[model samples]
Target: MMSGEVVHTFGFTVYFVFALMFTWASHIQRTNPGAGWWALSISSAFFARLLYFALLYTGDTRLIITAYAFFIVLEKPLMLTGIVRFLNLPITTRWFWFIAALADLWLAIAWVGEFDGFTRIAGYSLINTSLLACAAWLIFRHHKVVPGLSLRIAALACLALAAHWLTAPVFIQLYPAWATTGFAVGTMLTLVQYLSLLTAVLSLFQKRLLESEARALDMAFLDPLTGLNNQRYMTTLFDQALLLATRPHHIVAIFYIDLDNFKPVNDKAGHAVGDEVLKAMAQRLKDCTRSTDICARVGGDEFVVIGTQFTREFQVEEMARKLLEHVLLPIEVGGYTFQLGASIGVSLYPEHGNSLTELVQCADKAMYHIKRNGKSGVAVYGGETAGGLGLREA
Candidate 1:
């Protein structure tokens, strides 16, 4: 059987390695307060073990034991505090200090009273068990929010370590001859606890990296002002719609809308109010289209709506009329009321052109045709005008 001193030396080495790893992590992630606390916690454990190993050869058992007990009692409270901070759980500073003080007082009482070895060990072991159990409970409670296999494994390791501590006193009393073996097993459990916690921290960093990438993608593909898909994303949607249009009885319709009398709103009321108007217009466009349709802000005062899977050409005309009616509504912004109008040009798949660029060009020409005749109406690419519903007569 391995001696107790050998097990202590091995435990010291484990704590040292973990201390260095946590210190490096904290240095790299200076913004992560939890990492710093974890580094401190592990470093305290490393120092306590180092102090014990150093005093082993001094031949003064009382001084060595007292120093080790004083330093070791600090480890659990610091670890619990680090766990709370790392998980972003709400815990008061007073509570942390109170727990630390209580642990210290208990140790002082055991030492001053000259308690038996078993009594001292059992009391300290129970304290450690409670702290480790609390850490495991905290991690388990936050599993849903900070989800990862590593975190779950860490929680399990903590619970196992706590159970080991809870059984340490009984094992030591029942099988004094096997105390060395128990110490060896506890040291292994402690090593596992350190490794799992380090991996769990790395997992948290990975989650943050993924979320940042998603936000960047959103910024790249979406318009900042109106929250609509930009022209770049519209091309992708157009290609998808074109693929669906290849099916029998399926048609794609594009409505190119140019706001009439919009420039004056910007020139007179300032760009801020003009932005509000554009946002209102974007919302109206969304309200007028189906959820399957795509809406995009392609240019200044120019928007596009693409509808797919239409069975009939008349449905396109009806959709165009709905858009015209919605655009003609009065917009109220900043205590000012303004009536807006739109010149809408419609293009159909296989009738106007094949590609988005070609169809948009055809729609642009038809929109100019409406502007030449009279604004605030819809015109098809093939000279068919949708005239009704009190539209502006040309």
Candidate 2:
């Protein structure tokens, strides 16, 4: 075979590979019909391109190129849709594909030689330009929602296809061989794009798995009702906090928060409603906390919040103030609102205790003092006096 034939032959073969791959992918998506639709649509478009090229390079006839130009153009937008749908990226509809198909049919059939060549060029240019503009719009709209890797790879592929389509007129002049060479390069480009998509898909799956595992771990160590770390987990957290606190410039605060009037909800509305109220309260506590803070439920209506990266005592106090307010507010559920409040006691590192047990004991004592002082407040453990421990308002 001539070199040109070789160039064109593999070009057709590459398209065939894409066609079969898309078809097989769709077929195997028996459980996922949505994905199957996407695959079939993409495969059809690739099949069209393959058939067009298959005829052109083998027979060396204007008939194939002339007859299939519209088919080729029509396939472009469908190609995009396939990728978008495959990635589960959002799209409104097939409007772009419809418009492209119409434009392609008109251009392929209507263009005459010489006199109309410029118009043909302009026609295809406008249509292809619209396709590119649409692709860009899709990318921009989804940039924030799409993952970084997926965005980079998909966007590059779209832009490449657009470039290839737009340069049709000029490519003929630069090197009459440019088209054949582009075919070979394009095959490699397709392979790279496929690999990238595969990477993105794998990343997505791995991300989901990590999230699931994290949730499972959380459930194992978290009190779902109060959204606080369970006793075992909180103890571990306390030890970790203490270790972190030993470092220079690292300060940690341990707080034991006890709810006031919590038993009333369980008594009046029953445990089910009480459970709902508890869940709501826990969510509020979570909302009030920073990401680095560890909040845990150590007992019934008893919770703890550990603050890391704390440098000053005031930070702990401010946090207590926020927590107090968070728990004091009325929670509304099922058209009924209920008022509840919490008492909090804080103990700082080095001062409260050198050990986790000492710190927790000190904070617990301070919490009792707050309860005795009539609740809805914060108390901090002061230094030990000659007789006993000291509790101060925070």
Candidate 3:
């Protein structure tokens, strides 16, 4: 509805605004793969439009027109490449760059050789539409796997932009009044595309936020060094297992494990090597314990294994032997082989104590009894220290 000059000026303003906004956004997310490319594409497109209006107002120059046409044709491919990178898809660098270069060359030749206005328009429309169509195909093909509504909308926006460019030449040829209204229509279409792109950007930020929160939650419950459950996580499982132990014929076994002569390894080799020993031991403990059992690293050189569903008394002893055998195996760390040993003290539900704290204290006392007699051994909680194998008076 505005005059041609006003429409053209406002159109330039819109492009400049989006260009600046995307540029700022790209800097904020500079680490992201496709952000920089998309920013450059948007700014280049804005530059092309600015030059087009400048040439029309002043004396027309074929070279300047060619440069503007080059950027206009270049925009879609840049955007498509950026989208592909954003989606983590493989890029065929050779074929894509070759085709883009050849298209630009053709446009340059056409403009310098004095091609008619309709010929130039057709050339740009065909190339730009084809590029947008390719982008749409890529988005649609991957949409189901990613399953984002914003991505779907982005693909539809690409299709709509392609359709607009494809029909532009025909509309100009058929309708004599198209020249008057063409700028307004082009500006509106550009606005729609810009808004769609903005939506996709917001969607990406939301996805990143969700991923960060999940990582934080996982870190809360897991030990980063040993990749095992922490003391807090073990306590939660212990409480749950305690409630289940109230049923008939159910017994919960707690093993308080300590690494024997472990400080010597840290003194001989640096803490880095000692860390490797701990990781290797953690893996071995996980392998020795049954799937129903929960193994946790509760201290620097202390671990715990809680097992439920103990049908036989011998099963716990058998597991303790396996734990000792695995931990005794020599581990290679930082090109040095070191022998490791473990002392475990086991306490059972109802037999040792009813509560988790009582069971742990019982197990700890039994463990210290083993440590006092010898470094590496397993002992069960007996009636009392005076009465049996390894236990304190009740």
Candidate with the greatest TM-score versus the true structure: 1
Runs in model 1 lying further than 4 Å from the true structure: 1-6, 28-31, 58-64, 105-115, 149-156, 267-269, 383-394
Candidate 3 has an lDDT of: 0.77
In the range 58-132, model 1's lDDT, one tens digit per residue, is: 986555656766666677777777777787777764665566577667777878898776777777677777877
| Residue 253 alpha-carbon offset, candidate 3, angstroms | 2.0
Each model's backbone clash number = 0, 1, 0
- When 1 and 3 are scored with TM-score, the better candidate is 1
Question: lDDT per residue, candidate 3, 1-394, as tens digits?
Answer: 6776677678778888887767776777533556666777777777787887777766564566576768777777678777777777887645555666766877777867888666767777787788878878887777653336766776887888788778887887788468548767767776776666665665677777788898896698888999888888887788777766677878888888999989988999989999999999999999987777889898999998898877677877888888889999999988989987877888998898877788888888778878887778888887564655555321
Pitting candidate 1 against candidate 3, the one with the higher lDDT is 1
Q: Scored by CA lDDT, what does every candidate get?
A: 0.80, 0.68, 0.77
> Model 3, residue 323: what's the lDDT?
89
TM-score of 3: 0.70
lDDT by residue (1-394, candidate 2, tens digit) is 2354575556556555655654454464232233344344345445545666567656734455545555556655765574566455656657877877777666655544422543554566567666755665565456444366664765576567667667755775566656566556655555554445444444555666788899999898988776678978987777777666777867788888898998988888788888888888778878988877888878878888888877777888888899899898898865668899888888988876777778888899889888887988899899789976677797
In model 1, which residue pairs have backbone atoms overlapping below 3 Å? none
Stretch of 10 with least lDDT, candidate 1: 385-394
- Name the lDDT of candidate 2: 0.68
